[model samples]
Target: MEQNILDKANEWLTPTFDQDTQDRIKNMLAHAPKELEESFYKNLEFGTGGMRGIMGVGTNRINKYTLGKNTQGLSDYLKKSFPNETLKVVIAYDCRHNSDTLAKVVADVFSANGIHVYLFSEMRPTPELSFALKHLNCHAGIVLTASHNPPEYNGYKVYWQDGGQLVPPQDGEIIERIESLKYEDIQFQANENLIEYIDAAIDAAFAKSTIENCSFNTPTLAKENLKIVYTSLHGTSIKAIPGVLAQAGYTDVNIVKEQETPNGDFPTVKSPNPEEPEALTMALALADNIEADIVIGTDPDSDRLGVAVRDTHGKMILLNGNQTMVIMTAFLLEQWKRAGKIDGKQFIGSTIVSTPMMLELASAYDVECKVGLTGFKWIAKFIKDFPELKFIGGGEESFGFMVGDAVRDKDAVGACLLVCEIAAQAKASGSTLYQELINLYVDHGFYKEHLISLTKKGMDGLKEIDQMMINLRENPVSEIDGQRVVCIEDYKNSTAKNMFTGEITPISIPKSNVLIYYLEDGSKICARPSGTEPKIKFYFSVNAPLNRAEDFETVSQELDVKIKNIIAAMQLN
Candidate 1:
């Protein structure tokens, strides 16, 4: 058994992994040897996002050793990319297990290499990290977080000089540098002189910037009579969310006690995601009891917002991500237009998988709407790609999103602040948020969307996922729920074709492993593999005009049923 495992370790210990890593592998083999093979069978590859895995002592796991290797590669690329330049980088961590330790490890490596480091003294929101990168003029940034993933998981996210996730040539270059390093060669020593803990200055800057953009018209909006409920879903948002609201003059904010504190396990919610209504159950119930005006939630890192508003029947109904994005975008555009804030060159970005209602609204309002591959990084890329255009806001169908470009990433903090401002705007007009949504739908046509994810895990399951993508690419489904395919947009192939008219066009977006089918009846189906998880997702979107407000309930219920029926018909369930 020892011999067999030794052969396995030798198979993977290429020159890039170094002597210390190989010695550790050998030492483990000498004791609990078979396990060592499992640990070092492969070096964790740098994914589209940064490194993420279960924490353990393995080349494939997320530990100090693995993180050091990743940081070393990133540092090398930073030096090459900014040679002869004064390079500064910001580092931050969430409340996940070992998040702070991993963040410090990253700081150590960069500081040891003589790069300036502005490290967060404690765990903070992901967006604040992005904000620091830009506010301090850092060339790069790193945040230790797995976002809403489960307790055992942790991750590394790299950012560019623009405060957005790295993109294209830079991302590829960093990956190359990381791939070139051996574990032993990573600069792991601390250079305390070059690394400074940043808390007060950045906190002040972030809060000041947020307050300066405060949109609420009156301090009276925060009166005790107007009860507001909030939850962090056991993530980092709780720390600053209340302070932010309080600073905004919202004194009546009630916290969901169970989820107020940051915990990596995300003890209260089964899944720490704000997109799912189930995750908001505790906060929703609390809001109902207090007759709250609104309920808001943020994911683990506090970059995305989940909102619940009083419906027509006065029930606290939660809005799905699509519905939430539509409301927020319409409100921002409307507010900007009414205030004459639109300079005619501003733009908003969203993923291709997000609801197209925003696209329609943007066109109607004469604002440019840009669609990128699914991820905030692409949104940031769009911001960087066009320096002249002001990126007002961006979001995805996932609960993760951003309301401003200040941080260059999805900011749950900014989202929370904006939602309060939006709520204030609604209250000032004598309409609840639900009513405001209906107003948008009444002016713009009604659109409803839903998503389904099929999880396929483990080694065999991983293979099956790959095969599923191949199968779909090979055998395209021409119809779903009896609607004939009108157009097929194969993002992988970078082509869009008319199934009937045979009209061909190029998709200007970057190539991704996504397939979208548009039906003759205007229904749409999209197939995409989860970038961060082992799941295949199918998104269905359907639209119908709402002739009257009374029909809102009936239409919404029907749309929900239609979405499920279509999913069943497609056998994605």
Candidate 2:
């Protein structure tokens, strides 16, 4: 055993920690030296977002002690930021194991520190927590969920009064407060008077607000014809999505019973992430059984959404994040224009890794389109920066979408409703959702995107990822897939270099670890490390002109082959 790890593990045995935690530490020390080292060698980092890790009893894990310390830091920062005003925070949790317990611990810390706490009486989706922050006029909010990680993983995400994740100096300032504190500094005792339980009222209001963001009027005939299947993947959406769909006038909606229950284990899927096909297996099976018009699934926390639509051959096919974004963005803009709502002040947003078709759509509609960094927090920042403009909609390529500025994060509840409405309207117009996607490709040029994520686990994986980024920066590629590399955008350095012109332009965003290569043939490949996961992701995007819907197959295959060749040339496989 290393001396430092042994010393850190010894701290947990103090009288300050409970007997159960001390005993767990003792057990690890006696039998599991490797586990002890992994748990105590370093503290779990509270990154720009928040803390996420496997649940266990260690400074490097998501446990009662770690969560308490984080909450205490947040409480301290809140008091410092608004010394003259009364501080109030809202806390919500998902169905992850121990999430409910962690939420109460967070509330207890806040209440103990003289801050009013509005704790949900039941688990709720993460977006609802974001909405509650604004609706309740609170100072900040926290949600206990890991989004789509594996069963053993859990997280705590903090949001500000503006209903978005913390940004800039705030995130850094909060981290400084957290780092300055020790376990003994956390206030674990609860003040019952300052903690209030919230339920039904907030749910009703959030559901109503989500429904109001719908762009199209309810199509009674279409709603009756569109058969939909939905699964919450054993998370919080089971409490609200079906009700929202019903409110939107959809009569035929089926829920995947096997996954409808809010079970922390997520028994039916290997992972709770809707971005993966296996996560939607139960919903897809149910859709096939009922011959449903569309199948929709949300991640454990219900902020991200995945959809499967019947193709031209009447077989169900899942739509990637980019395709969903294009379809939803186009539908919203077209509806806004048809209703004479598209003034010059309306704008849409997309991340750099997302397909560029959004730019073309915004230009064609004569509206502004802004590109941000990877996270929806950046999109939220965009909305905050340009309050003069109306934010119509926006999304990324990771199955996350935000419609309207009502909620300042990626909202799966509202997204599910809007997507269902789109499907219904398409059905009424004598088409399928898949066909509508084809029409989008025909109108806007055909765009195809593929993402490959390579997971490298444990501490060594971190070093390997860093080395990969370093090598890419030091030895930049000049060509790929038989095409000259016309441009290289190093987001870390905030510069874009033109390979031919030798001109360097500034990228108007904060420094992040991202690299994008643009080929002369109009192909783009972006390399970025996941902020919330132990993985590095490569995003490939290629495009071609679609003359007609009949040639969809050929064009798609060509683009797929092109993506394969590009990946091979880059040796990503």
Candidate 3:
């Protein structure tokens, strides 16, 4: 069996794979049986998120073989989904390693299979692909992006006829078709004439929808410079962001020069996640030097966004994902109300683990806010299900936010443009965006969320994780860090238990292995195992209304201390 694996690996040692990938595979085969099995295990299954893995020349990696197989699966699924169909599928790629080549391979596979392919002439943002999927009314779509993952990874996201990620039975059906064939079964070429280049048409559609989605109807905030700083994080938003801001009439736009050029390796940041302050280090430095009013950064795919603002001390302060979502949603809701954009039937959505203040804020304004399972796909599902009811926006604590219904997926480029617009609008109102956020804290109460990931690698690691979950279920904790757990939501069992009455209620949302403990003090702790990575994540949320601005740091310190104590008590380092 080992020899068979080696032989299979050796076969890909051909000229099809680049020398670097070929050499890496050769090196992996020489010494690491454990690594080899992990690398080749059953081919990284492509589901709704499509495909993702560390880039390499293995059946398990996101190389040409995997990318081609996925495209073939999509082609087969598309044909079955729309029989007698002249299918059109739009394709886009990000700035991750092998993203462009993998996208071309996907285009080739689809076009070669007799599907009309609309390929981006160059690299584009992930949300633009989503917009193209809808604009062209494509039968399907594919975006080659690992999202906010580290440098070693890349991904392929499959969009369905509804311009959303494949969900439910369709997701399973596509996976089955992809598994039915080997690498050799994939089609990788096409009549080039059938593959049309799609650039200006889709770009125009995206820009038009984006501008239309801007809620700055009154433009009361345009009189000020706003002094905004934004970085693409060497991803896909370099050109369109500045262009959108310039078009939005903001003259004081500053871009981070060192990280201006798109590079897959992401030389500047250790990781390209805006949720982490370290990722925005360069942008913050630039903002301080330029004394910009606000700073924002996007990930490799530009679907998620991060922002920073100056504190009263005149120092750049990074906002967490919760803070970013809260501000955006609040700002949009206010603008919509002022412009009478609401029909009272309009709604928004957010994940369950996101800051709860959004649901309250939406309710206060007569806007419907529903909680869905994690991932933008679920949020998109809501958007597709309710065509009559408008979807104003949706976001998660993981730094994903999408505004308007222009695109089903998260749109960082759109959000980036809107953030600057919000800043300008606020400056015109004779206040800063930070002051607006503080006002929100005063209105909806303050919230701070902390995420802790514990990685467990290897097959044995999976078992250990399962055992941990089982233990947590069977021997449930009554308290953590001396705080009573008033309620426990077990997503695996789909039940919410009330500690006082011993009553159990079903969770209407999707069933997952996530558990949320709602404390009496309104703080929440959520434990969820990652579906893609070898890790379990714990989300800690704590907040206390500040009596005065002078006591903000004191309250923040208390929350941090509470989180540290809880983690320490749980023995989760």
lDDT by residue for model 3 (76-119), tens: 88888789878899999988878877888888888888989999
Query: Candidate 3: worst 10 consecutive residues by lDDT?
Result: 215-224
lDDT of each: 0.81, 0.91, 0.81
As a whole number from 0 to 100, the lDDT of residue 207 in candidate 3 is 79
Stretches of candidate 3 above 4 Å error? 1-28, 46-49, 218-224, 457-464, 547-551
Instruction: Give the lowest summed-lDDT range of ten residues in model 2.
Output: 42-51
Candidate 1 residue pairs that clash: 29-33, 303-412
Clashing pairs in 2: none
lDDT of 1 by residue, 438-495 (tens): 8778778788898888888644556788898899888877777878899999998999
> For residues 1-573, what per-residue lDDT tens digits would candidate 2 score against the true structure?
779889989999999899999999999989998888889878887653467888998888999899999899999999999999999999999999999999999999999999999999999998999999999999999999899988899999999988998888788899889989989999999999999999999999999999898637856888989999999999999988998888878889999999989999988899888899989988898899989999999998999999999998999989999999999999999989998998799999999999989998999999999998888888888898899999999999999999998898899999999998899988898898899999989998999999999998777788899999999999999989889999999999999999999999999888899999999988899999888888999999999999999999999999999999999998988
- Most accurate candidate by lDDT: 2
Instruction: Spell out the clash pairs found in candidate 3.
Output: 221-425
